[model samples]
Target: MSLPALSPYHLSLALTLPGLLLLWRNLRFRFYASRRARKIPHAQERVLILGASSGVGRSVAHVYVKRGAKVCIVGRRRDKLDDVARECRAMARGGAQVLMVKADCADPEEMVSLRERLEEEWQGLDTVIITAGVSALRPMMSNAGVEMDPRHPPKSQATAEGLTHAISVSNAAITGNFTGPLVSALSLIPLLTLTSRSPSILLLSSAAAVIPAPTRALYAATKAASLLLYQALAIEHPQIAFTFFLAGTIEGDFRASAVDKALPPNLTSSGSGSDSSEPTPLVREANPAKHGLKVGWVAQRCAQAVDRGEKNVFTPMYMRFGHLFYWIVPAYVEWRARVKYRYT
Candidate 1:
């Protein structure tokens, strides 16, 4: 069937409407950025960070310390926590207070004790950033030590051992990526709401939470769970600002600490260049230190997002489009993911 052609005015309106919307969005972002800059973290502000012993959490602690915020870093390793606390102190030039608490965020008892300590020491909390997460780099079936041929599928009972292994791996991922943040949030929300005029919580989530990828079955599922939990919290408590930092691959030893203990292929290669043709590098790459976003850069951006009370922030900004593209062409996205992770 032939349809009537649009008028020139209709064509002009179609093109102009998108440009106007883009212009409006740009202006709004700038407005909030400027407003947030004026209210950066102050010396008296108290920030409690979980999993601050290493990776993004450690870098974020340094960022807040430089801003003169009274920062408390919590982690399971006392030695690493001490190192982070010392580094934060050095970064602060002795101007900011750094508190180190050795506690597991996933442990409900530990979280409760940590919250009580913060209440007694700081009297309240202004900001809470949960960055503790474990990555899994094996495909769903491989995680269970199973390799199946579609044409000759094994009986369901034959996969019992593989299922057991998968469950164990899944548990670790859930504890680190989901339970930790859930416990910490439940313990600290009251303190945040009661103590600070501008209470903010930043969850260091990943693009995997929203965009499906190869070798991320458990990691993505767990992260998505926590991401939704905080999202629900945001709606339930409108007074406290919640920012979900949906970052892509970040330069660090994060993968080294994956629950699966299976690093991506070519883990040691030193390729630093990202493909300029792609909108964003949302795939696993070799030597994240060379190819991924700098840890410090991400931390600074995260702090800025918190200061701005941003709801969801995607690092490199272009990664935000990935969600739209995935929704439109999921198979294409999955194929690219398989290629990046070297699954095919």
Candidate 2:
């Protein structure tokens, strides 16, 4: 069967609907944003932020404190936490308190203690934002990087091995990025003193959950698993508002930290020097500048989502389309990935 060629009018007609839809969406978003801006009034709030020492966590802490929220910042680094606490204190408005708690998210005991400490210090929490996660970029899953080559010997192997082991153990256990936040949220939710009618448990996820990019199999798997857990939790626990911030690459120190914790392959064997200690091999990292979003913008968007009691959110909102597109035509996405990321 032969099809008739489209005339100029037909082509124009085809574009009309899409153009109208775009205009409508823009207007709707503007109205929605304005209403949310007015709705989320500044007042004292009890907020617990995990991994708030730096990056998106720190940005969110600053936003909350600026609006007169009592913020508790948690991270493994005491010094970084203290620095974030100091910044939060300075940024705080009227009577906003900033507290720093040093703890590891992967540690059940530490997490339990964190819950107990929060219970003692504050009556309840209004919001719990968990943004602690680890991701390493490697060309392949098995090899950490070329750092294990004989040309390079590490000054510290025990520490690297220990950290890598912990990351590995957590990845396998439910307590890693997969369920650590969930467990932490569950422990803290019980102590939630709801300031507003809707209390929120916000998880900071990644777009990798749905994108399925290369070189991030473990990272993407963990994040996707976490989303599923939270989505199910949302249905099970209807009393609390459980939301996810599915973020893209953001301008933060997360990448740097992940790289630092990344251990060289055969770290145990490579730790010992052979007469001459070779210089540490540097892992080639992608410049996140290509895809990074500003931490402040992401924080603000997340804050609005929490206030609006949204269920799922994507930073740089347009990324939401990619999720829908992937679901609608998964084969297209797979083909695109294979072409762009060179995934076999």
Candidate 3:
């Protein structure tokens, strides 16, 4: 479709298509998002979750299974992934059909293999949620294995993808979560229209992206870029409902300590949590809590939000600040984040 250029009237009309498309698409997914799950009670539809062995992904799997949805879990650890799969079967009412894909979500070749398997088995899924990420306790400088740090100065721990560790994770999600899954599923939109009620896509992004995590240099950058990527994609393809769940500083394995203790005097007793080895002023480390969810609490909250057809999804109540911070005062928000979390 070609159109004239430099015409005020034409330019004005050009702007109308996106807005109109968004409205129409939102209305469509309004009915389309949850229809299949709600419609097929006994024989629940399958939900494919990448990084489901732990964290929010596992919680989401259990949540859907409880409400009678079959779940497929994919993650790096076969044993851990299987454990989650077993748990899904235990909790699932209709008897969850849990499948495990034991491959790093960051590997393109493995992803290709997965795509083939999925194409054969399920073809298209009703819901796809991507919550895969990587973070390190110390900077490249601190690690002894590679001298990529200022003190040590060694090079080369790159992946076959020819990207850094952080980049590979982000690339896989972009390809698998946004590019592969979104395209593959939307490719079957015709099929979706015929079968399911509502087909929605949920993407998990960090509040750190908007806030700017200096320690997690590459990780934060890609996440920040991805947030915009989804926003633009949402505008482009409004017919498909896209929900970006901005999660907060979750209080679990992501937090580790001698013992779970109270927050500093400043934080509220209920909302705040503490840990000894997580991103502290001097160092950072990955604790299991990074994958921790209040399990059913957060999952059920998300399920209800999807049911109500809400656009923005946040886990804790405070994350509503993400909207105001990301949209209204991104610069200040980022500046403040840098002060609080980085270069200490």
Candidate 4:
């Protein structure tokens, strides 16, 4: 085949193509931003946050309080919830109220009580954020030891049969990572719908929902399931905004607790044994700040998404590449993921 002559016009066009595309991309992004710039009226908003005592949820509460919204923080511990409420109250603008409710979302009775409390206190909810979740880092069959608080009874005291029962109990608790949040959302739907402001439900899910995560198969499945649930809910309920956050790593004890709680009781270790005496190392304890966004920063982005009525939120926006890449070439992405996130 005969080739065309190398011309100055071709060279100039080729040289400018990259810059032209870059300019177009930037302009498109600016247009989207300008459209999302409408201010979210926060005055009189009644927001209820699950897992709000710590981590990203806690930070979200602070953001809402600052924007002059009545905020309720829920967690497992009363003391921790109280501390969070105090912090939010201090940051609140105008007369925004902060309520601390110590309730485990996994417990049906607690969720019901939470509903009653919200109805009594705020009368209705403007925003409901479900951030309560536990990590499933270890394999399903692994005999990772159960977490024992010094203040509570040690798992070492339980008999073999009792240990088996405890394991069963622990597995149920692990299931709460999904069930609890689901119940919380359903229980508060009526209140959320009745809000004076634009009602929204924000679910803080992990990027693991879409990306393959080794040694975290169960965790990934649960997250993916949650996203699917809300995506459907969004379709069914057009009047309400259902936003799902496919978030990356952030600073928190969620990983630690997940590892601790999901672990089976150590069968071999007992009192006076050297193995039992030493401290047990957690599954994966690396500084999230070194690898991912800060908790407070991610929370602010989430709040902004609510303000903008965005249906899907991705933190450290670069994560969109992985999602896009996986869909384009699943095999290639999976192969790379296996090598990059090899099971330990």
Model with the higher lDDT, candidate 2 or 4: 4
* Candidate 2: residue 62 Cα off by (Å): 0.5
Query: How far off is residue 315 in model 4, in Å?
Result: 2.4
lDDT tens per residue, model 4, 1-344: 99887699998999999999979866765654344333234666778899987888889998989988888889997888888888887788988888888888888898899888888887767788888887766433333333343334554444565457446644654565667767776787776666544677889998888887655666787788778878887887787777889887776667765633433334433332233454333344356657757888888888777655677777668678888999898887777665545432
Worst 10 residues of 2 by lDDT: 139-148
Query: lDDT at 42 for candidate 2?
Result: 52
TM-score of each: 0.84, 0.74, 0.62, 0.75
* Candidate 1 per-residue lDDT over residues 140-179, each given as its tens digit: 6655554333234432222455567778889999999988
For candidate 2, the per-residue lDDT at 240 reads 80
Whole-model Cα lDDT per candidate? 0.79, 0.71, 0.57, 0.72
When sorted by TM-score, best at the front, the candidate numbers are 1, 4, 2, 3
TM-score of 4: 0.75
**TM-score-best of 2 and 3:** 2
Which residue window of length 10 is worst by lDDT in model 1? 268-277
Per-residue accuracy of model 2 over 56-130 as CA lDDT, tens digit each: 888999999998877889998898888898888778898788878999887778888987787778766678888
Off by over 4 Å in 2: 1-41, 144-175, 193-196, 259-286, 338-344
Which one wins by TM-score: 1 or 4?
1
Local distance difference test, candidate 3: 0.57
**Model 3 lDDT tens row, 1-344:** 88546688878888898999989967765765456446555256667777787877788888888767667778877887988888888887766677778865656677667656666776656666766554433332222222232223233343332224334334533553345334433444444344455565666776656555555554455556666776776787666566777776554443221111222232221211222223223333233255434655766666665554566676665667755776787877656655555443
lDDT at position 339, candidate 2: 55
Among these predicted structures, which one has the highest TM-score? 1
